[model samples]
Target: MLHYAYGAVKKSMEAYVTRTGSNLLEVPLPFAVKSNDEIVSEFRKALERGKSNGNRVRLNVIDHVTSMPCVVIPVKELIQICREEWVDHVFVDAAHSIGCTDVDMKEIGADFYTSNLHKWFFYPPSIAS
Candidate 1:
């Protein structure tokens, strides 16, 4: 199950990089243990680096990490980060957040989103969409 979820994320990242010609793709730490301020600081750094290097930077944020309970990124901050010029794309991995939390994709404004229903909603192992 973990393999498939990661595979989907990998493919999506590849697609974004290919489409936008982005050389820098930033992914948050696993389990997302960092505080909101820390995450935003890192994202800003990545954007600054991308701007200086003349590359588009993409941010991949996991709404909720599977390994750590209560480790999540706030939607408001995510939206703010997405609005930055250096951020070409924002991908949200909501695999652990789909059914467990209230998520409105339209409000979040992510360029891409993926969730595994089977993990929480009990749909099917291969039915992630």
Candidate 2:
């Protein structure tokens, strides 16, 4: 499976990966990126790297919006690329997506998508959907 490099992922998701004992392949998102397309291109390279090693990328854990610097990731484009590359699963952590952006799950096409309502919708703490 693949995940965003440091400063781009939530701590809980990292901890969950550690607990599950899955090997993580980190894909860096340039802090000074010129465009969202740059990030998408990096993802494509990672997928290609995995394929070059004769392995299909099993999953891609995408952040709909990164937490650190609060950049909105191109989740829809990334998911579409994953589909084209035949990635088995795409899990979108949309923790900051709701209310902050227009989200349509059907169009996004991620296998798993989650958002914390409390993060934007003003729900009580720990409430998410």
For each candidate in turn, the TM-score is 0.66, 0.83
Candidate 1, poorest ten consecutive residues by summed lDDT:
1-10
What overall lDDT goes with each candidate model?
0.60, 0.78
Pairs with backbone N, CA or C atoms under 3 Å apart (clashes), candidate 1: none
Residue-wise C-alpha lDDT for candidate 1, range 4-70, written one tens digit per residue: 2355566776786789776534544435345777656665665566667564445644454443445
Model 2, 16-36: lDDT tens digits are 669977546777667776798
Lowest-scoring 10 consecutive residues by lDDT in candidate 2?
Answer: 1-10
Position 90, candidate 2: lDDT: 95
Candidate 2, pairs of clashing residues: none
Candidate 2's clash total is: 0
CA deviation > 4 Å runs, candidate 2: 1-22
